[model samples]
Target: MSIAPNQCTVFVQVWVDVNALAQGSTRGCYAVSNRSQQSSGEGSANLHTNVITSSNVCWTVLPIDPQYTGDFSITNVGAESGWEQPPAPVAGMPNVFTGKLTQSTVGGSVNSNIQFSFDGDNQITVTLPVTITPVTQ
Candidate 1:
């Protein structure tokens, strides 16, 4: 994740195909997002569901960041952990997940990878290339 070195927070948006995963033979889905702590010696991230569809399926989403501390879990509105899988197959629009990154302190260049797993067997991973550089005042 490449971001302004002087910032306090990092924002990330992820789009996923829940319908495709649900309609398939898979039984679950996992969505993930990652970000590094800013130069301020604080790091954290928040996640939320943006797009919506029918809630007929079940899923589990978790974060896998190395520098994560405390609580930073996100799930669908009616989901139990992280986000819920759609009840039925979706069409046209895609499911969206949003996240915020915070760190305990400036940890140099960070590489965060957000992953989405479906049906326990199918999985997809997305990486956030964050580049932090010193900014002039």
Candidate 2:
């Protein structure tokens, strides 16, 4: 698999379908002005459903409290990593390298940074960036 010079689109769909507490005929929907970690309200009631980060996307979301020492085993080799699949549909394939992403929450502010690089790139630095998304629930 090969990543071109530009292509890192991380689309996180928060809570656009959830209906919040109704005041009248107007049903509540996710508004662009809402920004809060505890926005997942209705999900806790129906379907016992909770937001689970879709790991299929390239990033992982860390909480806004405490801190984290990012660590995970690599799940693929460079050739068949992201979009490319291994020649054989074998299980337990590993990533080329491992990394640590650090995040800390202070004064109600969330700060996080995750870094990953392609060791093969000699001329330039290759990396995958992490994105945080807030949604209504």
Candidate 3:
């Protein structure tokens, strides 16, 4: 029996509550993804996916308060060997961030964190946990 390769694109949406931040609270910020099972912390989510070998992951930040203007960046916390570093924001999609995952021979289970930093008058950074399991083809 031949096992087919599993490949997919995961989209993670990041929501920022400007009013809450203005009021000195970071709890309003949160992130959710189509493949995520649960959410955690301020602007964090737990992603569980079977597309381990090659997957396209993207994150887009949406501010609750339109008046709020700022910039954000993705920082790698502890990604494994198969994980590819996040590249610069896409030209047309300024708010979108993306990365990729390659196949790893020295496998186990892949656990990683993708950290996002929002820069404005006050900088707020959060971590999103991602868990990926390799699929044999």
TM-score of each: 0.23, 0.20, 0.60
Badly placed stretches (over 4 Å) of model 1 are 1-9, 18-108, 120-137
Q: What are the per-residue Cα lDDT tens digits for candidate 1 across 1-137?
A: 21121231223433333443435622223332232222221122223222112111222233333333322222232211222221221222123233222221342322223333333234433332222222221
lDDT of 3 at 18: 68
In angstroms, the error of model 3 at 35 is: 2.9
lDDT of 2 by residue, 1-137 (tens): 42211232221211211112212211222221122233323222111111222212222211122332222222332232222212121123222222111121221211111222222212112122222321123
lDDT of 1 at 49: 22
The predictions' CA RMSDs to the true structure, in order, are: 16.1, 18.7, 6.8
Estimate, for each residue in 22-118, the C-alpha lDDT of model 3 and write its tens digit: 5656566666666544323324455555554566666676788788767666654335466564333554554665656566545765564556677
Residue 62, model 1, lDDT: 34
Question: What TM-score does prediction 1 earn?
Answer: 0.23
Candidate 1 global lDDT: 0.28
Candidates by TM-score, descending order: 3, 1, 2
Weakest ten-residue segment in model 3 by summed lDDT = 1-10
lDDT of each: 0.28, 0.22, 0.57
Whose lDDT is higher: candidate 2's or candidate 3's?
A: 3
